[model samples]
Target: MVNNRSLVIIALLAVLAWLASTSLYVVNETQRAIKLRFGEVVETDIAPGLHAKWPLINTVHTFDARVQTLENGQSRFLTAGRNALIVDSFLKWRVVDPNRFYQATRGSTDRAEALISPRVEQSLRNAFGSRDVNTIISEDRDDMLADSMASLDTAMRDEIGVEILDIRLKRVELPEQVTQAVYQRMSTERHAEARQYRAQGQEQSERIRAHADRQREIALANARKEADRLRGEGDGEAANIYANAYKQEPEFARFYRSMQAYRKSFEGNNDILVIGPKSDFFRYLEHPAGGASK
Candidate 1:
C-alpha cells in the first residue's frame, strides 16, 4: 500500500512537468513569434517574452525579425534603345507584418525571397526601360530609379509584408561586342582630337617662327645700310681733310706724298722694282727740293 501511493505521486509530478514544458515557450529579442491554433493563425505578432499556451492545442512559429539582405546578381534587362544590360545589385529589407509575411511565404524565407526578387527586378527594369547605356553612364542614375524605388517599396510592403529600406547598384555592364565597339569609337575620336590639336600647334608655331625670321632680316638690313652710310661719310671726310692740307701747303703735301710712296715700295725685303733711271718716279730720289735737281 505504501509503494502504490509513492508511485502515484511520482507519476502525477512527471505529467505536470511534461505539460509545463510543452505549454511554456520563450521568444528572443531578435525574433517574432506567431501563435497558430491547429495550423490556423490565431495570434498575429507576439512580442519577445516567455509566453504560455494551451498544451497540445496551440503552437508557436518564430522568425528572425532583424533586417536582411537579398543579393541580386546578374539580372538582365532591356533599355530604351533595345540594348541589354547585366545588372548586379542588392536590397535591404525587413519584415514589418509577420502575419502577412507568414501568410504569403508560409514562414519560408526562401519563398519570401523568391517573391520579392522578381518584383525588385521588375522595378529595376521599369527604371532602366527609358535609359540606354550611354544615358545611364553619363547621367544621374538616382533620378532614373527614384520613382521605381518608391513604387517597389510600396509594392513589397503591400504584397510581401516586407519594407524596402534601400536598394543599391553594384555594377552595370554591356555585352562584349558592344563594349568593344564603344572602345573603338572612343579611340578614333581621341585620335582625331589629337590630330586637330597638333595641327593647330604647328600652324601657330610656324607663324611665330616666320615673324621672328622676318624681324631678323629687317634688323640685318637696317644695320648694313647704317654701316654703309657711316663708311661713305668717313671716306668723304678723309678726302676733305686731304684737300684742305694740300690747299694750305702744296709743296709740303707733294713731298709728304712722295715719302709715303717710297716707304711702301721698300716695306718688304722681297720687294723689287725695275724701272728706267730717268723715270719721273725717281725724281724724289734724285733731288730733295720740290722741283727736283734741274
Candidate 2:
C-alpha cells in the first residue's frame, strides 16, 4: 500500500512538471505573443523571453512582428484619361497593433493578406483615376507614385490601423489594344509632319525660282535699254562731228569727203573710175593758162 502511494505521488509530480513546461513559453527576438483565457485575450507581450501563464487554462498565440515584403501581381487599370494600363506593384508592411490584427484577421497571415489586398487595389484604382496616361508613364511617374503613397498612407492608417512601410510600382505597361492604337496614331502624326515639311520645302523652292526669274527679267531689260541709249548717243555724236567739219571749211569739207569716198571705193585690188576734165572732180587740177576763168 505504501509502494502504491509513492507511485501515485511520482505520477502527480510528473504531471505537474509537464504542466509547468507547457504553461511558460519563450518568445524569440523577432516574435511577439498574446495570452487568451477561455476565448478572451488577457494580455499581449512584445518584449522577448520568459513569460508565464496559468497551466491548462490559458493559451499563448505568437506572431511574427518583423517587416514583410509582398509583391503584387500585374493588374489592369484605367487612367484618368480613360487609357488602360497594366500595373505591377509591391509593398512592405509589418504587424502593428498585433492585438487588432489578430482580432480583425484571426491570427492568420493569409487572412491579413486577404484583408489588405483589396484595400491596396482600391487605393491604386483611386490614384490611377486621378492622373493622365502621360503622367503615369513618363518621368513624372515618381511624383504620381509619391502622391499615391501619401493617399495610401492616409487610407491604411484610418481604415486598417496597419503601417504600410512603402508602396512601389514595379512596372507599367499599355494593353495590347491600347498599344496598337497608340502606334497607329503616332504613325499618322509622323506622316502628317512629313507632309507639312514637304509642302514648306516646295513653297520655298517656288519662291526662290520666282525671285531668280524676276532678277533675270530685270537684268535683260536693263541691258536692252542701255544698248539702245548707247546706239542713239553714238549716232548723235557722228552727226555733230559732220556738222562741225562742214561749218569750219565748206570747200575743204567737200574735198575731204571726196577723198574718203575715193579711198573706200579704190581699196580693193580691182577698181574702175569715170570722170570729165571739166567736172568738179578735176577742178583743182585745172590751170589758168589752159582754160579761161569764164
Candidate 3:
C-alpha cells in the first residue's frame, strides 16, 4: 500500500512538470509574439520575458522583430528618355504590428514580402519613369532612392504591418544593345571635340607664325635701311675729303690719283694692258716732273 501511494505521487509530479513546461513561454528581446486561444488571437503584443497561459489551451507564435532583408531580383525599367535599364534592388524591413502582420499575411514573411515587393517595384517604376538615365546614374540616385523609400514606407505601413528601414539599389545597367549604341555615340562626340580642339590649335599656331614672320621681315628691312643710310653718310664724307684735298692742292691731288690708278692697274706682276703710248693713261707715266696737263 505504501509503494502504490509513492507511485501515485511520482505520477502526479510528472504530470505537473509536463503541465508547467507547456504553460510557460519565453519572449526574447529580439522577438515579438502573439498568444492565441483556440485558434483565436487573445493577445497581440506580448512583451519580452516569461508569460503564463492555460496548458494545451493557449499557444504563442513569435516572429523575429529584428531587421530582415528582401532581395528584389533584377528587373527592367524605362527612363524618362525611354532608355531601358536593368535594376537590382533590396529592402530592409521589420514587423511593427504583429497582430496586423498576422492578419494581413498570416504571419508569413514570404507573404509579407510578396505584398511589399509589388509596391516597391511600382515605386521604382515611377521613379525611373520620371527621371532620365543620367539622373538615375548620377548622384541624384540617392535622392531618388530616398523619395522612393519614404513613399514606400508610408504605403507599406498603411497596407501591410511592416516598416521599411531602407531601400538599396544593388546594380543598374543598360541593355547590351543600348550600351553599344551609347558607347559609339560617346566615341563620336569625343572625336569631334578633339578635332575641333586641333583645328583651333592649328589656327592659333598659324596666326603666331604669321606674326613672327612679319616681325622678322620688318626687322630685316629696318636693318637694311640703317645700313644703307650709314653707307651713304660714309660715301659723302669721303667725297668731302676728296673735294677739300682738290681745293687745297689740285696738282698734287691729280698726281696722287694717277699713281693710285697705276697701282691698281698693275696690282699683279702678270698684269697686261693694251693702250696707245700717247693715251691719257700714259700722260702721268711719261711726265715724271709733275708737268702733265689737266
Candidate 4:
C-alpha cells in the first residue's frame, strides 16, 4: 500500500512539471512575440522576461525584431537615354509594428520578403528610368536611391508594417552586345589618334633633318673659303720672298736660276740640245759666275 501511495505522488509531480512548462513563456530583448488563443492573435508586443498564461490554452509566436537583409538579386532597368543595364543589388528591412506585421505576413519572413521585393524593385526602376547611366553610377547615385524610397518607405510602413532602410547596388553593367560595340568604337578612335601622332612626329623629324643638312652645307662652304684665302696668302708671301732675294743679290739669283735650268735640262739620260753654246743659257757653265763672256 505504501508503494502505491508513493507512485501516485510521483505521477502528480510529473503532471505539475508539465503544467509549469506550458503555463510560462519568455520574450527576450531581440524577439517580438504575439500571444494567440485557438490560433487567433489575442495580444502582441509582449515584454521581455517570464510571463504566465493558462496551460494548454494560450500559445505564443516569436519573431526576430532585429534588422533583416534580402540580398543577391539582379534586375534589368532602363536609363533616361534608353540604355539598358543589369543591376545587382540588396535591400535592408525590419518589422516595425508587430501586430500589423502579423496581420500582413502572418509572422513569415518569406512572405514579408515576397511582398517587399517587388515594391523595392519598382521603386528602383522608377529611379533608374529618370537618370542616365553616368548619373546613376556617379555622384548622384545616393540621391537617386533616396528618391526611390520616397514612396516605397511609405507604402511598406503603412501596409506591411515594415521599414525599408536602404538599397545598395553591387554592380551595374551594359549588355554584352552593347559592350562589344562600345569597345570597337573606342579601339577605332585610339588607332586613328595613334596614326595622327605618328604622322606629326615624322613631319617634325624631317624638318629637323633638313635643318641639320643646311647647316652642314654652310659649314663646309665657310671652311673651303677660309682655306682658299690662306693658300693665296702663302703663295703671295713666297713670291715676295723670291723678289726680295733677287733685289738683294741679282747675280746670285742669276747663278741659282742657271743651276736649276742645267739640272732640269739633263734630268733625263737621253738629251739633245740644238741651241748655240754661246747663248745666255750657258753663261754659268762658261764663266762659273753666270757673267757674260768677256
Candidate 5:
C-alpha cells in the first residue's frame, strides 16, 4: 500500500509539470505572437510577458517584429524610349498587422516576399516605361522611387498587412549587349558638349579681343589729337615771341637773321660753297662794320 501511494504521487507530479510546461510561455519586446486553438487563430499581436493558455489545446506562433530587408536581384526594364536597363533594387518592410500578415502570407516570410517582389517589379516597370532613358536614369529616378514606395506601401498595407518602409535602386545599368552602343552614344554626347563649351569660350575670347582693339584705337586717336593741339599752341607762342622781338628792333632782327643763315651755311669746316662773290651771302662779309644791305 505505501509503494502504490508513492507511485501515484509521482505520476500526479509529472502530469502537473507537463501541464505547467505547456500552459506557460514568455514573449520578449522584439517578438510578436499569435495564439491558435485547434488550427484556428484565436488571438493576434499578443503583448510581451508571461502568459497562460489552455494546456495541450492552444498553440502560439511568434515572429520577429523588426524591420527586414529584401534584396531582389537585377531585373531588366524598358524606358519610354524603348531602351532596356538592368535595375538592381532592394526593399525594406515590417509586419504591422500580424493577423492579416498571417492570413496573407500564411506566416511564411518567403511567401510574403514572393508576393511583394512581383508588385515591386511591376511598379518599377511601369515607372521606367513612362520615362525616357535620361529621365529614368537620372532626373526622375528619386521621384519615381518615392512614388513607387507610396504606391507599394498603400497596396501592401491594404492587402498584405505589411508596411513597405522603402524601396531603393542599388544600381541601374544597360544590358550587356547594348552597353557598348550606349557607351559610345554617351561619349559622343560628352564630346559634343565639350565642343559647344569650347566654341562659346572662343566666341567670348574674340569679343574681348575686339573690344580691347577698339579701346586701343580710341586711346591712340586721343593721344594724337592731344599731341597736335600741344604742337599748335607751341607754334603760336613761338610766332608771338618772334613778332615781339622784331617790333623791338627791326634792324637787329634782320642782322640776326643774316647771321643765322651764315652760321647754318658754314656749320662744318668741310662745307664748300660755289656761289658768285657778289651774292647776297657775301653782303654781310663785305660790310662787316655797322650794317649790311637787308
Candidate 6:
C-alpha cells in the first residue's frame, strides 16, 4: 500500500509540472503577446515579464514590437520616355497594433513581406513611370522619393496592418541598352565640345598673329616714309646753301666746282681723257707756264 501511494504521488507531481509549464509564459521586452482560445483572441498583453494562461486550450502568439526592416527585390520599370530601368528599394516598418497585426496577418512577418513588397514595387513603378529620364536621374530624385513614400504609406495602411517608418530606394539604373546609348551620347558630346574649344583657340591665335603682322607692316611703312621725307628736306637745305655760296662769289664758286669734278672723275684706277683745248676740262690745264693765256 505504501509503494502504490508513493507511485501515485509521483504521477500527480509530473502532471502538475506539465500543466504549470504549459500555463506560464515569459514576454521579452521587445515582444508583445496575444492570448487566443479556440481560434478567437481572448486577451492582449502589452507589458513585459511573466504571465499565466490555461494549459493546452489557450495559445499565446508573440510579436516583435520593435522596428523591422524589409528589403525589396529588384524591380523593373519604365520612364515616361519608354526607357526601361531597374530600381532597388527597402522599407522600415514597425508593429503598431499587435492585435490588428495578429488578426490580419497572424503576426507572420513573412506574410507582411508578401503584402508590402508588391505595394512597394507598385508604388515605385507608378512614381517613376510618370517621370522623364532626366527627372528620374537628376535633382528631382528627392521628389520621386517623396511621392513613393506617400503612396506607399497610404497603400500599406489600407492594405496591410503595419506602419511604414520609412521608404528608400537603394539604387536606380538604366537598362543595358539605354546605358550604352547614354554613354555613347555623352562621349560624342564631350568630343564635340573639345573640338569646339580647339577651333575657337585656333581662331583666336590666328587673329592675334594677323593683327601683329599688320601692326609691324604699318610701323615699317611709316618709318620708310618719314626717312624719305627727312632725306628730301636735307637735300633742299644743302641746295640752298650752295646757291647762297655761289651768289656771294661766282669765280670762287666755279673754281671750287672744277676741283670737285676733278676729284670725282679721278676716283678709280682706269682713266681716259678726251678733250679739246676749248673744252671745260682743259680750262685748268695750261700749255706751258708762260704761253698759257696768250
Most accurate candidate by lDDT: 3
CA lDDT of each candidate? Answer: 0.88, 0.78, 0.90, 0.88, 0.89, 0.82
lDDT of model 1, residue 264: 95
Q: Provide the lowest-lDDT 10-residue window in model 4.
A: 135-144
Model 3 spans > 4 angstroms off: 1-6, 230-271, 275-294
Question: Which regions in candidate 4 have their CA more than 4 angstroms from the true location?
Answer: 1-4, 37-43, 140-144, 149-151, 207-294
Instruction: Give lDDT tens digits, candidate 1, residues 25-88.
Output: 9999998789999999999789889999998899898888898999988888899999888899
Clashes of each: 0, 0, 0, 0, 0, 0
TM-score against truth, every candidate: 0.79, 0.62, 0.80, 0.69, 0.81, 0.71
- Candidate 5, residues 1-294, lDDT tens digits: the string is 999999999999999999889999998998888999998999999999999999768998887789989898999998899989999999999988888888888888899999999999999898889888777656755677788789889999889889999888899988999999878999999999999999999999999999999999999999999999999999999999999999998767877888999899999999998998777777768876535446
* 83-167 per-residue lDDT for model 4 (tens digits): 9998988988888888889989989999999999988888889988988878877755667788787678889999978888888
- Kindly list the per-residue Cα lDDT of model 6 for residues 100-197, writing each as its tens digit: 78877888999988888888787778888888888877755656678678767766766655788887778888877779898999999999999999
Give the CA lDDT, 0 to 100, for residue 10 in model 1.
99
* Per-residue error (Å), model 6, residue 225: 6.5
Give each prediction's root-mean-square deviation over alpha carbons. Answer: 3.9, 8.3, 3.7, 5.3, 3.4, 5.3
* Model 2: per-residue Cα lDDT over 1-294, one tens digit each: 999999999999999899879877888888767888987888865568888888878888888888877777898889899888899998887776667766777778787777778777877888898888777666565566676677766666555445688878888889977798889999999999999999999999999999999999999999999999998999999989999989998767766776677678679887877776576554444642223222
lDDT winner, 1 or 5: 5
Q: What lDDT does candidate 4 reach at residue 42?
A: 90
Count of clashes in candidate 3: 0
- The TM-score between candidate 1 and the true structure equals 0.79
Against the true structure, candidate 6 reaches a TM-score of: 0.71
Model 4, total clashes = 0
Stretches of model 6 off by over 4 angstroms after superposition: 1-9, 219-294
- State residue 112's C-alpha deviation in candidate 3, in Å: 1.3
